[model samples]
Target: MLLILSNKKQLLLQAKSLLLSASFQQLSRSSELTFTCHKISAIFKQSRPALFNNLYLAMSTQPAKDHTEGHKIPFLLDDHTVTTVRESKILVILRGLPGSGKSTLAKEIEQKYKENSRLFSADEYNIKPAIRSSDGGEYAKLDEDLNTCCERREANLIVLDDTHHDRERLEELFDFANKYHFIVVILEPKTPWRLDCGQLKDRNHWKLSLEELKNLRPALEKEIIPLYFGWFVTKRDEDALRKTSQDFLEQLGNFKPFKKRLQAYGYEDKHKLDLLKYFGKTPNILHCTTKYCDYGKVTGSEEYAQQEAVKKGYSKAYTLHLTALFVTPRTAGARVELTEEQLSLWPLDAEKEVMPKDAFPRGSRAHITLGTATEVQDVQTGIDLLEFIKLQQAGGEREDMGEICGGRIHYYENGMWMLTLPRKIELKTIFSGYYGKAGVSAPQRGGKKVLLPTCQVM
Candidate 1:
């Protein structure tokens, strides 16, 4: 028996070497030989189980080249690359149906943040899974607990685990986050069987039926609030625009009025204004921002995105006519003139939000930020444009400083300058949402810096 076992091991080792040396395609070219080979392989696998198992394990564990490149699922947050923020508060809201693994994800997040995180769950508060009149009291207590945490600044990362199917409930949480200045991030589970009602019926602790799960799906499906909705510039157009913007900036630097304004703003070296460095490199994709939905925390964000016109416009192409280029002390951008058809995607109260009392047209604030000044955010570009519009409305000073780069320049108050082009520069763009990364860092109110490994933007 010992001699037979030794011979079997020797034969298997030789077969392994042969298998490694020859490709399966090469071996399978001969039909008769292939059939014989399969028979032999099956015999070895079935009879010599111990030896074959080792061979299988070794072959299976061999490293292969990764082909995914840098592409990642936009909604999923990687656990390994999670970062920590200093003096910044984060509110992570988990939304999903019963048995959708929200609790499991919340626990994982809690473990990752450890001491710096506080997790709130409906189950802990003895709140029933279904929406009911009696459940309101339990939910109120949960909110109070969360409020206390935010008030005392007890945790850097606060996680709320619940179905969150109700829009009103989400609104209440958004209000709390806004008041406390906490960055809100809404996450849903990435489990494959999350929406499979049959699987959920078996997996759910509540033992919810398929009917109940089906009813919940509609509410969640109707609204999907993105990070921010806007028109994305194509790669080819973006390159062209970059060059065009650079040329405009160069000519403006040499202009005498622009130079005179810079000198007034304490730029002693008129030659060294360096408009390129003054307005830093664009951080994100060049696009006209429509609505800044801070991850579904913004008021009426879901409803707005679900509007028929907005929904139809999403991912659709439109040619934006660049009417002018404007520069403020804080930002530099191109003013976009939306046509009647394009104005359908524009939010009704877009301008009213900026100047509530003033009655500017619906698409008055439509502009793409070419660049922003040091320490200034990209959102300021829209605000600056509105300021320019307000002054224009009030009949503020507008000195025509002559044409440069086929556009006439005008100077407003405090280094505010604009170049209105005679011929509109048109660029094709697609309406979409920006979900790249969360910019949640801000000045710390007062507390120790907490290292949160899982508080990442989805």
Candidate 2:
């Protein structure tokens, strides 16, 4: 990565340092560090001639043995690639509560497009004489099977029918579609939902009455909760990140450009930036987001919630490596380095929401929010990270005005910049999931739960 520098001398120095650090990391992981260095050299050669000069000189001095193995690194997926994939296949996601007629609509849609469409549902994955009880494991398996159907179904259109009432669950489906290059169309049943399944002749096809669907929360089920899965930061690491961010903000307050901007904003005392007061404390829930599902509002979220991989990996603990600490006037945060295993749960287009598909690769903004400006949402932290990285990618130069006790500070345009830490910080974190407020209720296990007429899904 070509981090912006204030001057030529610092640029060369930081470039050398960055390569050495990457080399060490690569060496530790495998014998691929040398090739990675060469790739960096190539990137710099094309985008940053000055820095490449320094890197080339340094690489010339290294032993030839370092270049023994070479591997071609793939480029990021561009719009053309995604567009072509989407053109070839499409995915239709059906959403609604049971008895909302989701199945009937899915069947009709599939039949109408029979020549090009195929339908998949959780009911197909259920065992013979399947029980009606809410079970996480069973749902997990069904999610996996549904995903498999998406992957292997030989058709231009695939329809997934289920009670996809939660958003977080739907995000998973989008993730799958991204991987497979399929376009997603969500269809919610329009018919009014009735309480009963109307006494199906099949004994195994049991349905809950309106009363049973209004009291208890369903465990491990996608319909009841809006779950967000991510990597949580440890207490110690979070403290260190917060301290670094605070110091960076204080230095930012001292910058002449920043001071002038503050004056323009009506701040006479611009020498000391009240970073703590200006930017509120970091959120209590510190995490590197893997996915954000807005209660199944996002396309394909319901299928994602039931995904088997997510279920099995839920709540597992892993070590997170902090690569850099960055601060902008709007936010302060840390960029996390995700391991291969961790990447499996990461949403393919997480960064694309803020930056264009060609601008940054997937997961480029994976970060922990340390703090945010007044009235800013916590999610802005990742946006700030993308802006910082984008500037570096463009070989945009900033002023290396000073340094902190823990890192070096550089000033970019618009009161945005980053503090590059001298050392990578590693913290132990758990792979936890989140469920927002229960928008709907389920039947109590042993009691007769009260029914609400409005309790329906779509």
TM-score of 1: 0.51
What lDDT is reached at residue 441 by model 2?
A: 22
The weakest ten consecutive residues by lDDT in model 2 span 67-76
- Root mean square deviation (Cα) for candidate 1: 14.4
Worst 10-residue lDDT window, candidate 1: 62-71
lDDT by residue (123-224, candidate 1, tens digit) is 788765666463456588898888888788788678899888876677677667656655555666656556777877876777788888887877765445
lDDT of 2 at 162: 71
> TM-scores of the models, in the given order?
0.51, 0.46
lDDT per residue for candidate 2 within 1-458, as digits (tens), equals 33433344454555566556654224434435455555566556777888677667765443222221211000012332222222335566766455445566676656656765678776677532222444335457766765676667667567887755444555666666545544444544433222223422211143555444432113212243244567655444444555555555666666665675554333664566665566665554467777776556666566665676655454345677877777677777888888887777777677876666556866787898877765677778888888888888999988886765456667777767676767777765545444433352211111222222221110
What TM-score should be assigned to candidate 2? 0.46
Q: Which has the greatest TM-score?
A: 1
**Residue 58 error, candidate 2, Å:** 72
lDDT of each: 0.68, 0.56
Question: Could you tell me how far off, in angstroms, the CA of residue 453 lies in candidate 1 after the best superposition?
Answer: 42
